[model samples]
Target: MLAKLILRNLLHHWGSTLLSMILLSTGVGIISLLLAVNKQVEDKFNRDLKNIDLVVGAKGSPLQLVLSAVYHLDAPTGNISKEEAEKLLTNPMIEQVTPLAYGDNYDGFRIVGTDSTYLLKYNSSFSRGSMFSNPMEVVAGSNVAKKKELKIGSSFTGTHGLSKDSDDDHEHFKYVVKGILNPTGSVLDNLILTPVESVERVHSERHEHAEHEQHEEGHDEDKTTGKQITALLLTFRSPQAMFSLPRFINESTNMQSASPTLEINRLLGLLGIGMDSVKAVAATLLLVAGLSIFIALYSRLSEKKYELALIRSLGCSRMKLFTLVVSEAILLCLAGFAGGMLLGITGMYWLNEKAADEYSFTLITNNLWNKDQFLLLTGTILIGITAALIPSVKAYRLNISKTLANA
Candidate 1:
């Protein structure tokens, strides 16, 4: 009977009920989106950082080098000689070396010139065809293939520079898609891989007007194109090298240096500030939703004073009367919470699709519920109960004679 009464009352105030539902759902949806993105980005980061012990790159801010080389974002920190990367491979503590060369793009995706070792480190394999075998042959990431609609034999020209609006298009050389990697959901998802020599060949052909010109500053073992690498990925021979090697690479040479684990953690801490603000705002909205429930219930009690008096005059205890009114409070909270979670999940994907339409990049949407989400729901529900307390007390203190006389 109480539930029926509550439903009927809500039906009568359809405008307020609908507004409350929208507000609650919007609050939860925002929090859900935040949680999904934070988890995914962090997961990709830790997975990529696992293999690389020290990153050696050109002389600039070590953080810049890491951002360009490791994360594959932004421009390179200037180029390190292919010779410099080779020397590190000879280190007694070094296990493997993967040199990365930059400065080119096919469409909006970054074209990274790297060797077989880079793919091998991630345990990545082509679902179709094989890795790049020669200069100008390229391997497309899963996202790259889908975005560019590229096939194994498809061809495209790379731009000379990194800018989204570069005029110097490298139409001279054709990059042939040789392979498409299985999706790994890391930085690899949106990249193209090729031989480090390709970076030189394309640019060298462009600047071939300059001739080899006594390449004095940076080259190694007959690097005919005189190309410099953007960075080197070092897998040290043992755990001890994790500490000793990065320092040696930093101090002993002119190159910038980084430990991926430490740097990424710092980056995450910085990102957490933005997430904390979102969570705080979600919490504040939940409080407002609870207050809405309280106000709506309290006003109903005011208009229904004769009804409360009739029930009280029939010998209903103050405690029972209080509980009867508070049940509506519980129903409001639950209805809002369910509506909120439902909108959060569906709306997040819809928003992601909308964002993908604007920016060329697509946000990944395969997220699942976790502890944090449950805790958030619990916290919001607790706030709802706390908000209902004052209205519930007012319901308990009803005087039958006074309320009925006024009615």
Candidate 2:
């Protein structure tokens, strides 16, 4: 009977009830979506940074170097000579060094030039065929093969720049798809792998072609330099190397070194500022929602006083009247929470689709249950209960004789 009464009251004041729910739901949905995206980005970086110590690249921003070399999400600073990078590999403190050479792309997916060790870093294995053994031979990442419809022995020419829209095509240098890699859900899953020499060869040819064109046009061409690698991903043999190696390289050499841990934290700190602003907006919305609930219940008390008094006169307890109002508030809160969760879920699906297509960064879609989410839900319920308390108290203290006389 109490549930029926509460339902009727809410239905009769459907405009106010729906307005309150819309405000609450919009707040909750924004917060939930932020949480999911932040968590997924952190997870993706942590997964991809496994077993890496420092990135050595041409002198520029450390963050850019890390983002380009480690995450493969941005353009490289510039290229450093292979000879200069090899010297770092010869450092006694260095355990491993994998050279990266990248300057071209196929359909917006980057082509990375590295060795077999790059495959081992991501725990990737051949899904078909064998690793590239010759210049211009390439191995396709799982996502690249699936999306680009590449197979063993298939050939594709690369565009000159990192973006798919590059007008400069390397038509003469066709890369054969020598292998396809198993999906490891890391940065490697979006790249096309080839020998570093292949990248140097293609760019060298490009340079020669440009020079030839300049000569034909009676323009002066600058002197060309040696073959260059984009960056070197290094692992150290000892903790002592962290203390000295990156500092020494930055101070003495033309190459700059960036720590994965420091740069990633710096990136997150910048992201936090934007996220905090969003959270503040959501909190403000929630506060407005609380105020709306309080108004809805308080304004209805005068109109419902007679009905409430008659129910009390007919043997309905004062506590029952209080419970009815409170129940209505609780129901609205729960309904809003459910709607918000659905909205958040839809946002997550959209993010997953974009991430997968662009970066091959697959977010864990199932792990939505967490302590923070629970706390948010609990806090919202408390807000509803608190808003309903004052109105419920007024209903409980009603004078049956006075209310009926006024009516």
Candidate 3:
């Protein structure tokens, strides 16, 4: 009965109630969306950076090197000589070095040329088939296999560049899908892995072929260099190496080294500023919604005073009148919260699709509700109760005879 009355009252003041709900919902949606995106982004970064102490790549922005090498979110700065990168493996402070080569793509999914260590780093195992054992054999990530419909022994040629739109297909070489990896929920889930030699072989042949064509045109020039890999992912033997190695590599070598943790933290700090600004705006909207609710309830109480008094005269308790007014506010807030959750979830789904399409990155959306959202609910309800308190108190203390005579 109380709920029905509250609903009917809100409906009677539909315009103001809707305005309040929209304001509150917009605020809640913005905050909720930020929380969801931030959580998944942090989780993805932490998961992918596991055990990776440093990244050595061609000289460029350290953040770029980390983004490209660790997350595969950008193009590599350039390629480093394989021979030069291999020298770091012999260092006493280096426990492991996984060299990565990037040059091609299949259906927008990057084909990463690294050894089995890459899979082990992500704790990935085969869901079907076996690991690549020969040149031109590849292991597909779970996403690649599912999206591209690659089966074991399936053959596909890679485009010459990292993008899906590249028309320069490597028609001379056909790569066979040797395996499909189980989902690891890391960047590996969006990559196709092959031995470093496979990438080296493809590019090497392409270089040689281009040279032969140029020679036939009477431009007798020899342009040759050693094999190169995009970057080197390194794990340190001691934590002290984290402090020493990046500086040493940047100062002493042609290649630049970046720490994933440092770069990611810096990135998050930059992102934090933008998030904080949006939160402030959202907070302002919430404040306005609270004010709107207060005004609407106060005005409605003035108009309904006589009705409230008549009910009191018929034996309705003062406490019930207070409860009735407060319940209306609660209902409005609950409706706003429900609308806000819907808006937030829809926004996340759209963002996830966009990220996957553009960067081969997807956020974990399986669990949307968390402790933070629960806090949001609590805060929203508190706003409602606080806004209605004065109006509810007025109803509780109403003079039945005076109100009736005035009416």
Candidate 4:
């Protein structure tokens, strides 16, 4: 009976109730969306950064080097000579050096040329077939296999560049899907991995073919540079190497080394500023919603005093009148909370689709409710109760005879 009365009262003042609900939902939705995106992005970054201490690549922005070499989110600065990178393997402080060569793509998925160490580092295992052991043999990531419908022994020629739109297909050499990897929820999930020699072989042949064509035209130009890999993922034996190695490589060698941890932290710090601003806006909206609820209830209490008094005369307790007033506010906030959750979930779904399409990345959406969202629910309920308190008190203390005579 109390709930029905609260519902009817809210329906009678539908315009103001809707306005408050919209404000609350918008605020909650924005905060919830940020929480989901931030958590997933940070988790993905930290997951991929595991086992990788340093990234040695061509001289450029350290952050870009990390983004490109470690995360495969951006174009590599440039290629570093394989011979030059191999020199780091001799260092006593270095534990593992995984060479990465990026030059081609299949259906928008990057083809990374690295040895089995790359898979081992991510603890990846075959979903179906065996790992690639020979040149031109490739292992497809789970997403690549599913999206492109690549089966074991399937053959596809890569486009000459990183993008699927590149028309320069390497028709001379084709890659066979030797294996498909189980999803590791890391950067490897979208990559096509092959032996480093395969990438070197393809580009080497392309360079040779171009040179031969030029030679035939009698315009001989030396365009050949020795084998180059895009970057090297380095793991150090000791923490001391972190201080000296990146500086040595940046200062002494043509290549630049970047620490994934440092770069990612810096990136998060920059992102935090934008997130904080949005949080402030959401907070402001919530405050406005609370104020709106307060004003609406306070004004409505004045109009409903006679009705409240008549109910009191009919033996309704003072506490029940107070409960009735507060219940209305709680009902509106509950509706707003439900709408907000739906809005946030829809926003996250859209964001995941956009991220996957644009960056070949997707945010984790499995757990929609977390501690922060629970706190949001608690805070919302508190706001409802607080906003209706004064109005409820007025209802509780109403003079039935005086209100009835005034009416």
Candidate 5:
């Protein structure tokens, strides 16, 4: 009887009831998107950083080392000699190692030169052809393969530096697209990998030209300069080495080492300011939703005072009347929440598609179902009950003679 009464009461003002529902659903959808974005950012970072434990680079910002080494999103602070990196790799604390040579690009995509271990460590297998067997032989990532429209045996000259459309093109040397990696849903998905020796040779020729251009007869011929690596990724003996080795590198050598775990946290903290503000706006919207429930229910209750008086005359208890109004509020909120969720999910998929095209940041399509959303639903329903409380109390008071007389 109560459920039937509740449904009928909501149906009495179907337009207003639906308005409440719309508010709740819109609020919930916004909340869901915020939570999913945070998860996406962190998950993608971890996905690409599966193999690297320690990033050894020239002394600078730890975050810089991480961004440069792992994502190729930042310029390197400087390079380290192969000899210094090799010596560190030989340390008993280090399990395995690979050096990254950056600072070259092809059509804005970063060119990475690392040993074969980079592919082996990530377990990245080629979809076509094979890994670089010798210098100047390059393997493209899935994004590179698809974007550049290249296949095995295709040759392309790489441009200099991280920037798109570099001022200097290493026109003398062109790399053969020897292979292409299958998609790993990582930063590696966009990289072009060649031999470290190729990178060294390009810089070597540049330095020699610069000296020759100066036309200084004997400017202390730079011999110590040979193959250089932008950064080195080290695998530690155990998790303990993550902490111990960074300290060891900082204290024992002129070189700097950074742990990805620490640097990633620091970066996240810096990034959260914008995310936090957006979340705050989402929270404010939910608050407006709750207030909407309160206002809509209260306004409808005013028109029902005479009806409540008539119900009391029919022997329906005041408590039952109150429960009915509260129940109506809940129905509206729940309907709105469900509608919002469906809309939110559809929008998320579209957003992901756009982001993939515009930024190449792959977003996984997964519906959000978490504790935060559960709590949100519960809290919205509770607000509905609170909104109906005063009306319920008024029904309990009845004032049957006065209400009927006034009507």
Candidate 6:
């Protein structure tokens, strides 16, 4: 009987009740979306940082080196000599080395000149065709192939630089699509992989052509120097190397060494500040929603005083009247939370699709029953209970004689 009365009363004031629900749901949805997106990005970054201990690049900010070499999200600082980078392999503490040669792009996707070891590092394998076997042959990531409509035997010229707007098109040297890589959910999914030799050869040929033109025009022929690589990703053979290697490279050599773990933590720390501010705003919205609930219930209490008194006169106890009001508030809270969660999931799916299409990046969406989400729901429900307390107390203390006479 109490439940039926609570339901009917809520239905009677559906306008204000719905407004309160929408406000509460909007607050819940914003916070939930933030948690989901932040966790997904953090997880993806950690997963992609596997097996690589340090990144060695030309002298510059260590953070920039890591962002460019490991994450492939920033521009390279500069280039170091290939010979200079190979000397690190001579260190007994070093177990593996993968040199990266960057400088060109095909439709906003970086053309990464690396060896088969690069693919092995990410645990990537071909999906359709085989890996690039010779110069002027390249393999595309699954997303690249699908979105760009590229296939085996298709050919395209690369731009001189990483940006898609670069007009210095290397039309003289075209790359044939030799293979497609299965999605690894890593930086590799956004890259065009080829042999380091191919990158060197293309630049070498371009330099030679310029020199030939200079010689024909009665100018001095400019001689090109030794080859350079953008950076080197290395793994340590011993735990001791983790402590000693970065210090040695930073202090002794022209190149700078960056620890992936440290740099990533720093990146996340900076990212957290912005997220925290947004979370604070979401929290404030929740408080406002709670206030709205308080106002709505309090405003309706006067109008319902006579009905509450009649119920008390008939049979309902003061405790039952209190429960009736509290239950209504809780029901609204639950409905709002369910609607908010649905909105959050839908927003995340849309974001995931957009990211996959534009950046070839994947966001983690499989883990929805996370503790943070449950905690938010629990907290929102608690807010509803708290908001209903004063109104419920008023309902319990209603004077049947005075209310009935006034009515």
> Whose lDDT is greatest here?
4
lDDT of 6 at 28: 88
- For candidate 4, write residues 13-116 as lDDT tens digits: 99999999999999889888888888888999999999999999999999999999888888899999888899998999999999999989997899999998
Candidate 6, 318: how far from true, in Å? Answer: 3.7
- lDDT (CA) per prediction: 0.77, 0.89, 0.90, 0.91, 0.79, 0.87
lDDT pick, better of 1 and 2: 2
**CA error at residue 272 for candidate 2, angstroms:** 0.8
- Residue 294 accuracy (lDDT) in model 6: 91
User: Which sequence of candidate numbers ranks them by lDDT, best first?
Assistant: 4, 3, 2, 6, 5, 1
Local accuracy of candidate 6 as per-residue lDDT tens digits, 235-318: 889878988898999898889999988999999999999999999998888888888889999989988888889889989899
lDDT score at residue 355, model 1, on the 0-100 scale: 56
User: Which is superior by lDDT, 3 or 6?
Assistant: 3
Candidate 5: Cα lDDT at 26? 73
Relative to the unseen true structure, what is the C-alpha lDDT of residue 204 in candidate 5, on a scale of 0 to 100? 82
| Candidate 5 per-residue C-alpha lDDT over 214-290 given as tens digits, one digit per residue, 9 for 90 to 100 | 66765655555656789998888888887688888888776788888778987888889878988778667667777
Q: Which portions of model 5 show Cα errors greater than 4 Å?
A: 1-26, 165-168, 206-225, 270-277, 307-324, 338-360, 392-405
Report the Cα lDDT for candidate 1: 0.77
Q: How many residue pairs collide in each prediction?
A: 0, 0, 0, 0, 1, 0
Q: Candidate 3: list runs displaced more than 4 Å.
A: 212-222
Instruction: Give per-residue lDDT, candidate 4, residue 46.
Output: 97
Q: Report residue 266 deviation for candidate 1 (angstroms).
A: 1.5
User: What is the TM-score of candidate 5?
Assistant: 0.80
Model 1 lDDT tens row, 38-126: 78678877777768888889878767777778877657888877776688877898888888888988766788999999998888879
- Considering only N, C-alpha and C atoms within 3 Å, which residue pairs clash in candidate 2? none
Q: lDDT: which is higher, 2 or 4?
A: 4
